[model samples]
Target: MAKVSIVDVAKAAEVSVSTVSLVLRKKGHISQATTDRVHQAMAELGYVYNQSAANLRSQKSNVIGLLFDRLESDFSIKILKCLIRELEKQGFIAMVKTGALTADALTLAVNELKTQHVAGIILVAAGSVDGGLTPVLSAAELPYQVMANQGGLGMSDLIVCDHYSDSLTLTRFLLDLGHVSTVLFGGELHDPVFGERANGYLEAYRERGIPARKAHIIYADTDLTGQRQRLEAALRSDNSISALLCHSPAAAMIGAQSVLKLGYGVGKDFILSQQKYVTCFQEVDRLSDGVMDLSYILLPLEEMAHHAVRQLLQRLDTPEPLPGRAFSGALIR
Candidate 1:
């Protein structure tokens, strides 16, 4: 049987071979009707791009796949935006997909990106998602890196921000401020980042000669109402703790509302904050206003994104696997 080629596809679709190539590569602007006609012609001809076969024949794809659970958090937004920008700067296209935090949902996203023939994948598993996703990702047999989320998942590389170290620094700073006790106000316990931050908080207390108190490490629901209730309850249960180490910006907002509801000022009795980016303050600072004397960390989102893109491209050339790396955040008052 004669194999179908781009020329045959163009002839069958009554379009130029360039048009067929453009449609196949998902490049340039092709009308939907024409694209459909070209696809129909290809289907009639049983045509496939043969990506794996082509890769073996000395060709490299300049596309990067970026997968994420969701894009609601400031951290997710910042990281994705920077990554895409950096990818474009280095002459690579970014294909981004997002879905629910479940393993199946993540698998679907990975599979869809796979269909696009992305050269490498940057899985931005931000937020409180943790679970069995490494298998599907590793099975893809493509160089992939996971950012900001971990679960013993197998991948080519892992990149993360140092949540534990930074959280420990923040906690120690709170202790230095004459606050005898501080509470890790709110976060999901299952998230790897949250767990690290929580550990840092405990370590800070332990190193300060204060015995670890179970009450200091409290986890809260992600919802605003649930967090507000938790904050109110925590405040009532112990007012001696003068500060909160919120793992999220939403949690900080809730804590602020709870403090106000109890007729107490922000800086006078309690302080709250989590993280932010200096270049894009509006997105991070929106939740900080009315929260009183908030001290947030400056996450180098742009720097992280640039490094991830650069590393992924280099790995594509060398195909050498590297160990996971964590970047640290700077404190911003």
Candidate 2:
């Protein structure tokens, strides 16, 4: 038995193979009568239009997969909400998945999403630029964007915070408060984002002519639990430190709790501030020294979603596809 393909359908309907493909793909370029005729011919010939095959050919999946590293982090939740609202504004729905912090986990998760035929993917590759998406995303044959922490690989487009200038501004804010001896409780400097923040902190120290003190700089984890140990160790190791520069609000909270738990007040015992992606003001109930804004970079989630949609539309237009476009974030603080 001969397999009924697009050519057979076109011959049966007295139309071009392109027309049959369009009809099967529901591109809506053909007229109603022609569409009905092609469908009728397809029914008569007992032809089953392979939807997956057609989708592969056209590369038009109206779905955008939103992936995050971890869901427990407040920053992740806030970004996800912002991204969701932005995607909805662009007339697109987001199917979100999380807990894929590792490279292997992300690869498997993205592969599973690919099976569902997503138009594209948007990922917040937090804590690490290598989200284990390189292999799968490269082979995906779809438009994808990564909101990164700088120096990310395989990001068709990247949206990152301006850590250098923002962090400098925040660190100087602590310096300006007459707090000569300060502690920098931050994440690992290996991370691009945190590395930038570290640069800013170092620049402030250089400008203030303060020698880099190893004990005053704490490489605390971004999460609260890990930070508790690091902050305690830092405070115990350094008695001259009277101020703190945290990386994120979560880090700031950990520092604050540690300051209080150590029988010291936030503003009186030690001054503090942090860098934020959206707005750190809302995250904290009170704002004192460590609450200065290092400028917020609003992620272009809506624009990214629109770009993915436009790419899908273009792929549906011609055999040759247009290249993906990258968009940058804005400093709103």
Candidate 3:
């Protein structure tokens, strides 16, 4: 069988070849209905758009590069799926690269994406790394965006959830429930993301004129066993601690289990709250059913993904540096 061509697709869609070309290039003011018809025609005719040939002619490709320092969390995975889906709807594809967060590794990754002629790049959670990408990405001269928790580069457009504000809200909710001695659990002490959240928790206490106890803020170890030990010890030593504000779902789970093991009723004898990606909240709810009373802040993972895609596309069109965007999460009881 012969390979299907754009002309065949144009004929089948009952549109001119130039219209089909415009649709393929994602340019011109094409109607949604007509675009759908052209896509259907291409699918029926098994016509594959030759992105390489198009790139050679236009010197650009409708490919967005996604760089990740790490992609290990449920939050990262869910946001990644959302980004890919939204990008595809706008007639673009994602090329993802994940590796160590070293400066050399990041520079190499940016260089590789540039070689692929990707229209733009999105750096997800890469700001956590020590050496920032401002110089590397600026030198590459490509339109790029950063989706991170904290500390963005100077040159890139950043899309971040308001962690400090959300944390303050969550902590205030717990305080309003009359829990004066609340403990903050999990996260690395030195991390900027953790610092913002911890500061928010502190600020809530400051607002209430309650002296925040230094001992109540406990950073979790990387391993579960260590966290369990520390949490159990904290509970045993502090009889006044009646509530916990966990930094993540995992920390909340551990706190709940530790409470139970200590012969305490979760909701009755203690209160537990956590921060969660919207996609993973159901799982946390399921696990905590009848076992713990859980309140949580829902991180705007999907919202951030949608905004990131839109901002990157706009950057591609205009190539002007825009100010960063911050989204706020909601506290759900």
Candidate 4:
């Protein structure tokens, strides 16, 4: 197939090549009808824009760096996608780099983005100790913002969703359902997200005047198999565990499987509360065969991404660091 060019789009859309160029670059003012026609023509011809080539020919690049601790996390990966879309809507691109959990890894990732000529960087998991990227924020040439997961520490525009309050809400919901004995599962304590969630679970127990048993609080690895193994053991050993509070979708699904293995129903035998990212319910429904129905507290992954990108873009124009922000999420069930 011949490479589709701007000229071809111009001819198909019945406009001059210069007008097509203008529309593509978003340079000069054009009628909305013409813009729609140009877009339609491009779509009809399956024309993909060459953003890299355009950046090469231009002085300033529209690429933004997205550095994170691990690509293995579903919640973090989903946030990465939202960041890409948000930047795209603002006429920018996301250049993603993973393995920035450690100081050395962060330095290498930032250097990688610097070579790509990215305008700025967005650092996720900035407070992870086993995967901390805190020591090298201000020294880098590129401007950066941190997604302050719970107690994340950094000087840049720190964006945080209320993991503490949301976890507390999920716990309180389970308690409201008359669940006296509950287990707090998923995520290791070194990670700020899990740490905050663990605290919330304890807080809920304290508020209800119920003593939180030490054995009930289990921290598992992020992997599905590990979550299943740990949860299965917990369920097998105890029949008193009537409710579950999970920090991630993976944990919630495993909790269901473990519950079933121990001959317990999902809702009637055991109520579950989850801190869910957007669309986690669909995934749970698909994976658990629609049996893992439970209450959930919404974690605003999309909103967090939107705010993070907007903050970065604002910094690009203003070149001044903004104060950190923390957003609270709402209940879904």
The C-alpha RMSD in Å for every predicted model, in order, reads 12.8, 11.8, 7.5, 8.0
Error of 4 at 136 (Å): 4.6
Q: Count the backbone clashes (under 3 Å) in each candidate.
A: 0, 2, 0, 1
> Highest TM-score among the candidates is held by which one?
3
lDDT tens digits by residue: candidate 2, 1-333: 987776888899999988887887788668999999999999999998645334434454556788887777545666677777766654466888885656678777788788888877777755456635556665666655666445455544445545666666666665675556666665775656667667877888898887777316667554657768877777766655666766666666677667656766555323244212112212344344544433334445556545544444344334553443434455343
By TM-score rank, best first, the candidates go 3, 4, 1, 2
lDDT of 4: 0.70
Clashing pairs in 4: 101-131
Deviation (Å) of 76 in candidate 1: 3.0
Question: How do the residues 129-183 of candidate 4 rate in per-residue lDDT, one tens digit apiece?
Answer: 3324545755676566788555554444568777778777877776776666678
What digit string (tens of lDDT, one per residue) describes model 1 on residues 1-333? 986788999999999999997887788999999999999998999998744333322324778888877788767888988998887766677888887756677678777877888788888866533436667777877777678743344443567777778877777777776666666766776766778787787888888887676327667764767767776787788766566667666666666666667766666333443112111111246544555456766776787897776666555455557666777777766
| Model with the higher lDDT, candidate 2 or 3 | 3
Q: What local lDDT score does residue 201 receive in model 2, on the 0 to 100 scale?
A: 73
The TM-score between candidate 1 and the true structure equals: 0.66
* Tens digit of per-residue lDDT, candidate 3, span 126-153: 3353326567776777777778766554
Q: Largest lDDT belongs to which candidate?
A: 3
Cα RMSD (Å) between model 2 and the true structure? 11.8
CA error at residue 39 for candidate 1, angstroms = 47
